[model samples]
Target: MIVVLLAFTLASFWALIAWKGMQERALAFAKAGSETQGLTHSLAQHASKSFNAVALALFGAGQYILHSDKSARASAEINDLLAQYAKNIPQVREIGVLAENGDWMFSSFETVPAVNNGDRDYFRYHRDHPEDETPRISEPLTSRVTGRPTLLMTQRLSNPDGSFGGVIFAAIDLAYFRSFYAEFEADLNRTVTLMKTNGKVLVHRRDDQVGKDMTGTALFSGRLKDAGTGLYSIVSPFDGRTKQFAYERLSDFPIVISVAVAEDTILDGWRGDRRFDLLLGAAISTILIGLAVVLALQTRKRSVMARMLRERERGYRLLAENVEDVVTRIDMDGRRLYVSPSIEKLLGWSADEIIRESAYSNIHPAHRELIKGLIGQLGAQNRTATCEYMTRRRDGNYVWVEAQLNFVQDPDEPTAEIVGAIRDISKRKAAEEQLVAANEQLKALSETDPLTGLANRRRFDRMFDAEFKRCQRSGSQLSVLFIDIDKFKSFNDTYGHSAGDDCIRQVAGALASCLKRPADLVARYGGEEFAVLLPETAAINAEVVAEAARNAVHDLAIQHHGSPDGSVTISVGVAGGKCDARNSTSSMLAAADGALYLAKEQGRNRVCVAAENPSLTLVRPAG
Candidate 1:
C-alpha cells in the first residue's frame, strides 16, 4: 500500500507539470495569432485607402480628358500626361487608353499599332455592363506592354451624352507588391495571397500560383463566406502541417487578402520547455521519495517537522516574490515586521530597508493620520479594510497605492499583526483627476456665451439665487443694470450679420469694463440685451456705474448707418433694492426692465434709474 501511494503521488506530480507546460504552449500560439491578425488587418486598411486615393486621381484625370477637345493637337499633351503619371505612380508598369470599340489607342511606353482588346475580361466587362461604376480589378495576366505579370485597375469613361466612351486602365506590376509582402515577419512556410471575391487568385507570393481557381478551398467555403476578416486553420497540402490563416477583405473593393502562419513555427519554443519540465518533474519525484525513506529510517520527528516548516516557508516566499503587489505584516506599535521582495520594485526600497526604516513614516504627511485611524480601527475590531493613499518612494516622489488590510489573529499567541497587500494605483488616480477637471471645463462652457465670451443666462440665474440668499442675512443692497443696444436689428440688416456680431462684442466689452469688482458679473441676457450684477450697491451708486457704461460705448465710436446718431450706443436702466426677506431677484429684474422701457421712451443712449419707491428718473450723462 505504501509503494502504491508513492507511485500515485509521483504520477500526480508529473501530470501537474505537464499541465503547466501545456499552458505555456497555449500562450505562445495565442501570441502568434494575435500579432498576425493585428498586422494583417492594419496593412489591409492601409492598402485599401491607398488604392482608393489612386482610383480617385485616375477618375479626375479621365474626367479632365473627356471634357477637353479630343483633337490631334491635344494627343501629344494627353500621352505626355499619361507618361508622366506612369513614372510618378509606384508599382504601375504602364497606362493605357482604349477606344469605345475596345481598340487600344494610346500606351505610355511607346507608339504601338492599335490592338483590339475586345476579348479582354476587364474591357469586355465595362463595355457589356455599364451600371458597375466601381473600378474593376482584373485577374493576373501577362502585361501587353512589358510582357511581365500584372494586375489591372480599369474604370469606365462616359461620353458627353452619358454613353460609354472607353476604358482607362493602369497595369500595376505584380513584382512590386510581391516584394512589398516580403517586408512582413513571415517564415518560409507562410503565404500572402491576394485574390478576388470570386476566389480567382490575382497575386500570390508564388508566381506560378497566380490566375488559379481557388473557389473550392476551405478558406473561401468556410471563413470568407461568413465574415470579411477572421482567423482560420487548415493543414497545408504541401507540407502536411496545420497552418493558421488571418484574412482581411478590401471593403471598398472586391479583393480579399490573406496571410498564413504555420502552427509548428509558433510552437517551436514550447516543445523545448515541455522536455525540460518533464525531466525536472521526474527528478523532483525521486528526491521526494528518497527524503521520505530517510525520514522514516531516522525516525526523528523534530527533523521532519523542521523540514516541513522550511518547505512551507519556501512555498510562501516563492508565491510572494512572483507577484507585483507587496505583502506586508506590521506590529501594533507601527513597526513593519515583514515585507515581500516586491517592495523593491514598487517603492525602490528593499524589504530589509523598509523594515528598518519603518513603512508608515514614509507616507505623505496629509495622509498619515488617515492611515493611522484606519489601522486603529482594524485592531479595535476583527475586520478587513481598504484604503487608497500616497506613499513616498525612495526618490522623494509620492506614488498612489491602494491597500487592503486584515487583522491577523492567532490562537497560540497573544499579540496580533496587521497583514496587507499594496498595489500601485497611480494611473487610476490620475485618470480620476483628469475626469473631474474635464467635467468642470464642460460645465463652464455650458454656462458661457460663445459669441461674446461672457457669462450666459444660466450662470446669471444661479449667481443671483446665491447672492439673494446671502443678502437676506446681511441685509445688504443689490443692483441690476438692464442694457440694450439701440437699433441693433437695423444695424445688422444694414451692415450684415458679421458687423452686427462685432458690434455686440464691443458693447459687451464696454459694459463689463465698467464693473471694477470681482464679485460683479455681466451676462448676455439674450439677443442684443445684457445684464450686470452689483452685489452691494445702492440705486444712486448703480446709476453712476450705468452712466459710465453709456460713456464707454459712446467712446467706441463704431459707425452705425441705421442710427440717427450715426454711431453704436447702448441704453442702460439701473435698479437697486435691499435684498432682505421682502425682496426677490425677480422683483428687482422687473424694476430694471420697467426703467429700461422708460429710458427708451425718453430717448435712446441714456441712463435711467429705478428708485426704491418704484419711480424712474433720468441720470445725467457722464463725461
Candidate 2:
C-alpha cells in the first residue's frame, strides 16, 4: 500500500508538469501570432502609402496630358515635370506617359528611349476596358529600359468626350520593397512577402520566389478567401517546415502583405523548459520515495523540512533577481520593506536606497495622490489595484511606469503587508503618443488640398454644415463667397497646363491673404473655382472682402491673354443671412452661385451681392 501511494504521488507530479508544458507551448505560439499580426499591419500601411504616392503622380500626369496641347507631348517641360516627380518620390523609379497606341510619349529618363509598351498587361487592360478608370497595379515585370524588375501603377486618361485618351504609369522598383522588408527580417526562417490579390508575388525576401503563383495554396483558397486579414499555419513548400503566418490586405489597394515565422523557431524555448521540468519531476520523485522509506524517522523529517525551506528561499531569490520588473514589499505604514535588485536597473536607484526612503517619494507630485488612492483600495478591500503613472528616476528624469498592488496577509502577523510589482512602461506610453499624433496628421491631410494647400471641397461641406447649424442656434450672420477665375479654360489653352497650375496657386495665395478672421475658411471648391465661409459677417462685409480678393488677384499681374483685363482677374459673388428653417446651406449656395452668374454676365472681375431671396442681387462695379 505504501509503494502504491508513493507511485500515485509520483504520477501526479509528472502529470502536473506535463500540463504546465502544454500551457507554455500554447503561450509561445500565441505570442508568435501576435507579433506576426503587428508586423503585417505595419507592412500593409507602408505599402499602401507608397502605392498612393505613385498613383498621385500618375493622376497628375494624366490630367496634364488631357488638358495640354498634344503637340507638346514630347517637350522638355513634360520630361522635366516627370523627372521632378520621380526625384521627390523615393519609391518611384520612373514616370512615363504613353500614347493611345502604347508608344512612349514622354519619360523621366535623361535620354528618351524608343520603347513601346503595346504588349504590357496594364496598357492592354486600360485600352480594352476604357471605362475602368481605377488605377491598376500590374504583376512584377522586367522594365524594357532598365531591365530591372518593376511593378507598374497605371491610370487611364480620358478625353473631353469621355473616350480613352491614353495611359499614364509609374514604375516602382521591386528592389525598393525588398529592401524595406529586409529591415524586419531578423531571422533566417522569418519571411516578408508582398503579393497581388490574385496570388502573384511582387516582392519577396527570397528572390527566387518572386512572381511565383500561389493561387492553389491554402493561404489563398482558405484564409484569404474568408477575410482580408487573418492568421494561419501551414507547411512551407520551400523548406517543408511548418510556419505560422499573419496577413493583411491594403485598405486602398489590391495588394496583400504577409509575415511568417517557423513553428520550430517559436517553440525552441518551450522545448528547453519541458526538458528542465522533466529533470525537476524526477528529482522530486526520488525525494518522495526516500521520505516514504523513512516514514517512522521524525529526526530526519526535521532535517528534510530545513533543506526544503532553504531550497525554496534560493528559488525565490533567483526568480526575484532575474525578473525584468521590480518586486517589492511594503508595510502598512507605506514604507518599502524589501525591493528587488531589478529596481536599480529600472530607476537608477539601488535596492537598499529604495528601501530606505518612503515608497511615494519617487512618484511624481501629481501622481502621488493617485497611487495613494490605489493603495488605500488594496488595504481596505483586500483586492488588487493596478495603476500607471510617471515616476522620477535618480537621474532627475521622469519615466512612465505601471504598478500592480495586492494585499498579502501573514498568518502569524497582526497586520497585513502590500506586495507590489512595478514595470517601466515608457515605450508603451511613447507609442500611444505617436499614434495620436499620426491620427491628427492623417486628419489634416484628409481635409486639405495637396496642390493649393487650402481646404478641399469635402472640408468645406463639413464646415458649411457645422456653421449653418451654429448660426441657426445663435441667430448670428453667416456669409459665403463663390469666386471664379475668368476664362480659366482659355488661360490653360494660352499657357500650358504647368503654367495654369502656377496661376491657380498664385490666385489661391492672394485670396487667402485677404481673409483676416479666424472663423473664415477658404477652400478649392472645384476646378478653377474657390469658396469662402465667413462666420458672424454681414452681407456688406462679405462684399468688401470679395472685392478685396478680386483686386488681390488682379494685383498678382500674372499674364493671362485670355482675359479682357489683359492679365489674371477674378469674379466674386457674395451671399449672407441668418440661417432659418427656410434658408438652408443649399439655398445659400444657390443664391451665391446665381450672384456669381450675374457678376460674370455684367462682365468679369467684379463682385455681386445676393439678397435673402436668392434671385435678387446687386453687383459691385470693377475698380
Candidate 3:
C-alpha cells in the first residue's frame, strides 16, 4: 500500500509539471507572434507610403507631358522638373519620360543615356492596353543605364484623342528596400521579406533568395488570398527551418511584408524552464520514495526523522528570506505574522517594522479596498487570489505591485494562515503607459501635414463630412473658407522651392493664430492652399474670419519678388448656409472655389463671399 501511494503521488506531480510546461510553451509563441505582427504592420505602412509617393510623381509627370507644348517636351525645363521629383522622393532612383516609340526623351539623370525601353514589359503592357490608365508596377529587372536591380512604376501618357503616347516611369532601386529591411534584423534567426503578391521576391534578408517564386506555398495561395494579414508557422523553403511568420499586405499596392522568427528561437526559454522543472520534480520524487522506505524499515528511528524534517523547514525559511519577491505570513484577520527580509529592498521597510503594521496600512487609500477584497476571497474559498494595486513606500512614493495570496490550513490545528508574495511591477506598468502614448502620437502624425504642421487633407475631409452631417441634423449653419497663397508658382520660380516652403509655413502659422474658437479647424488642403471649417456660423461671420486670416498672412511681410504686393499675401473666399438634402459639402466647396477664383481675378490680397446664387460678393480688401 505504501509503494502504491508513493507511485501515485509521483505520477500526479509529473503530470502537473507537464501541463505547466505546455502552457509556458504556448505563451512564448503567443508573445512572439504578437510582436512580429506589430512589426509587419509598421513595415507595410512604410512601403505603402513610399510607393504612393512614387506613383504621385509619375502621375504629375504624365499630366505635365500631356499638357505641355510638343516643342518643349525635351527641353532643359522638363529635365529640371524630373530631377526635382527624383530629389524629393528618396525611394525613386530615376524619373524619365519615353517617346511613343520607346526612345528616352528626357530624364532626371545627370547624363542622359540613349537607352530604348520599347521592349520592356511595363512599356509593352501600357502600349498594348490603351484603356488601362492605372499605374503599373513591373517585376524586378536590371536597369539598362545604371545596371542596378530596379522596379519600374509607370503610368501611360495619352494624346489629345486618347491614343497611347508613351510611358512616364520612375525607377526604384531594390537596394533601398533591402537596406530598410536590414535594420529590423536584430537576431540571426529573424528575417524580413518584401515580395509581390504573385510570390516574386523583391527584397529578402538573404540576398541570394531574391526573385525566388513562392506561388506554390500556402502563404501566397491560401492564407494571403483569404486575408490581408495573418500569423502562422511553416517550414521555410529557402532555409529548411521552421519559422513563425506574421504578414501584412499593403493597402494601395500588390506587396506583402513578412516578419519571421525561428520557432526554436522563440521556444528556447521555455525549453530551459521545462528541463529545470523536470530535474526538480525528479529530486523531490526520489526523496519521497526514500522516506517511505525508511519508514517501513526503521520505525524505531523516529527522532532522527524529526531532526531531518526540522532542517528542511530551516532551508525553506532561508529560501523565503533570500528571494527578491517579498514573502509574508498573515492571519485571517490581515495581521502580518511574519515578513521576509526582502521587504527592505522592495519597499524600504524592515521585516520587523512591517510585521507590526496591518497588511492594509501600506496600500494606497484608493487601492486598500481592492487588497481587502482579494484577501476576503482567499479566506472564504480557501484558494489563491491575485491582485495589482498601488502601495506607499517608506519614502512616501507610490509604487505599483502585484500580490498573490494563498490560503494555508494546518490539519492538526484549528487556525489558518495566509501566505503572500509581493512583486514590484512598476517597470511593467510604465511600459504599458508608454505604449499607449506612442499609439496616440502615431494617430496624430497620420492626420497632420508634415510641412505645414496643420491637419492634412485626409483629416480635413473626414472632419468636414462629420460636421456637415451634425449641422444637418441640428439645423445649424455651416461655413467653409477656401484660402490660397497669391501667385505661389511665381514665388517658387523667383525664390526657389526652399524659400517657397518657408513662405507656406509662415502663412499657415498666421492663419492658425487668427482662429480663436475651439471648433474652428484649419487644414492644409493641398499645395499652397488652405481650408477652414466653421460650425454654427453664417456667411457674414465666415467672411469676417476670412478677412482676419487674410490680414494675418499679409502681416508676415515675407518678401515675394514675383508678387505685385512685394510681400506674401492670401486670397480668401467664404461660403456658408444651412446643410440639408439640397446643400452638400461638395456644393459648398465648389462655391468657395468659385469665390476664390473671383478674388484672384479682381486682384490678389482680398476677401470674396459666395451667395446662394452663382454671383460673387466682394468683401473688404486686406491691408
Cα lDDT for residue 499, model 1? 92
- RMSD to true structure for each model, in Å: 20.3, 16.7, 16.9
**TM-score between model 3 and native:** 0.55
Give me the runs in candidate 1 sitting further than 4 Å from their true place.
1-12, 110-113, 185-188, 237-240, 297-623
Model 1, range 257-352, lDDT digits (tens) per residue?
Answer: 887888888788888888888888878988989976875666677578779767866876788778999998887777897789999999999898
Per-residue lDDT for 35-113 in model 3, tens only?
A: 8998899999989988988997787677666656767544676787799889868899999888889999889987667
lDDT of 2: 0.86
What is candidate 2's lDDT per residue for 1-623, written digit by digit as tens? 66788878888778778888998899999988998898899999999989987886776666656656756543777788789789877899999888888888788999667988888888889988977998999888889999988888988877789877778889898888888888888763688999898999888878899899989888788788789999989887656788998899898998999998999899988999999998888898889989988764565776798797678668767887789999998886789877899999999999987787789989999999888877877755567888999988999999999988889887756788898899999999999999999999999999998889999999999999999999999998999999999999999998989999999999999999778679899999999999999999888889878986886787678998878889999998888988888789988888888788788888989998887435454433354
lDDT of 3 at 83: 93
lDDT of each: 0.81, 0.86, 0.88
lDDT of 3 at 106: 80
lDDT of 2 at 208: 92
327, model 3: CA deviation in Å?
A: 18
Q: Please provide TM-scores, in order, for all candidate models, with all chains considered together.
A: 0.53, 0.53, 0.55
